[model samples]
Target: MKIAPDVVRAFTPTGKLRASINTGNPILAAADATHGARGVSVDLARGFAQRLGVELELLVFDTAIKSVEAVTQEQADIGFFAIDPKRGEGIHFTAAYVLIEGCYAVRNDSPIQANEQVDRPGTRVVVGKGSAYDLFLTRELKQATILRAPSSQAVVEMFLDQGAEVAAGVKQQLEADVLPLGNLRLLPGRFMVIQQAMGCPRSRGAEAAAALASYVEEMKRSGFVAEALQRHGITGAAVAPAA
Candidate 1:
C-alpha cells in the first residue's frame, strides 16, 4: 500500500509521531527493563513511524483511559485503543489489530460461577475507570452497579476492599490480581472480547482514519501483528479478524 502524504501528516502533525502508550494493559504494553514502554502496541507504533518516515515519540500513561484521553485531547497524535462506541465521540478507530478477552472474577465462595451470572441485582462490579471493560460493562450491565477503581491494576484491591461481588477486566489482569488473595477465581468463560485498534482524533478528518485502517489491514495480512505478539511473548490475546 502506498502511503499518502496527507495521511502521514495527519498522524504526525507534530513532526514526530506521538503514540500514547498505556502500560496499564500489560497484554498490549508494558515497561521494559530500561523502564521504557515495549509490547505489541509500542512495536506497532514504531512500525507506523517507520512507514511514515517520521520520528516516533511515546507518551506513556498508566492506564488506557489516560492514554485515550491524551489522544482525544490532541496531546498525542494517535493511540492504541479498544474500538468502543462511547469513545467514538471524539476518536475514529481503524480496523482492530488484536482481540483480548474480558473476564469476571469473584471470590471462590461467591455465587457467580458463570459469566452470565454476574449481572444480578445487588451485585457490585469493580473496574478501572475509563477502561474498555469499564465502558463495555457499563453499557451492557443494567442490574449490576459498577464501582470505579483508580486504575486497572487497582481493581482487585478495590473489589476486595469494598467487598464487591465481582471484579471485571482483561483476563490476564484478573488472574494476576487474584493471585495475592489466592481465593478468587475467574468465571468459567469470558464476558466479552475487546477489539484493540489504532485510533486518531476525529478532528484529524476521515483521510487519517482511512489511512490507518488500510495500514492495520495490511499489517494483519502480512503477519506483522501476529509476529509482534510472538516476539513479545504475549499470550491471551490474538490477532483480530479481517476488518
Candidate 2:
C-alpha cells in the first residue's frame, strides 16, 4: 500500500523522518541496518505510521549526535536518543518508552566492582561525547580522569585498548558486546538511569507532540511495545505511560 506523503511528512519537511540507528548497539542494530528494518525501533516507527494511517520513511544516521542534529535542522521529522533534560532546548521529546541503566565497563580482572571504586583517584573513565553517560560521569565522579570518545563504540574500544580504566554506556550494549571481550566487565551499579525517547523538532508545536505521545500510549497499552522490546532482547526497559 502506498503511504500518504502528508502522513510521512508529518515529522519532516520532505515527508520522511530520518531515524538514527547505532550500529554499535545490538538492539538498535537489530532495528535498523543489521535487520534491514526488522528491529524494534523500526517496528515501533512502522506501528506509529500504521496507527496514524500514514506512510513512514526511515533515514539512518551513523551517530546519535548526528540524528539529533538532523531533527534540529528540520531535515528529519523525528529521531530517537537517550533522553536528557539538557537536550530539551534543541528538540521536543515524546514520553519516554524505554529505561536504560548507565554503567561502567571495566577490565574483567579489575578490582572495580562498585560505584565507589569509580570515584577513586587515578580511575580513568571513558565516555562518548554528548551522551548521557558522559554527563553522568562528568557530574558524579569527582576524582576520576574522564576521557571523552567520539562514539559509544569508540569508548568501549578505548577501554579495551587500555586507554582508560573504564568505559561508560548503556548496560545492554555492554552486556551484548563489551562484556564478552574477555578483558571487560560491567560494574555492579548504574551511574545514571536514562529514559530513551523520540525527539521531534521544537517547532512542531504541542499538537504534533500530543499526537506522537498518544500513539506511544496506545502502543504500550496494546502490548506492542513490550513485544518489540522482547524481540530485540531488551529486558527490563519498561514503556512509560504516555503524557
lDDT by residue (tens digit), candidate 1, 95-153: 79999999989998997789888888999999999999999998999999999999999
Q: List, residue by residue over 69-109, the lDDT tens digit for candidate 2.
A: 77777777766777766668878887777777887778777
lDDT of each prediction vs. the true structure? 0.91, 0.70
- State candidate 2's TM-score: 0.85
Instruction: Judging by lDDT against the true structure, name the best candidate.
Output: 1
Off-target runs (Cα >4 Å) in candidate 1 are 33-35
Q: Which stretches of candidate 2 lie over 4 Å from their true place?
A: 1-12, 29-36, 241-243
Candidate 1: which pairs clash? none
TM-scores of all models? 0.96, 0.85
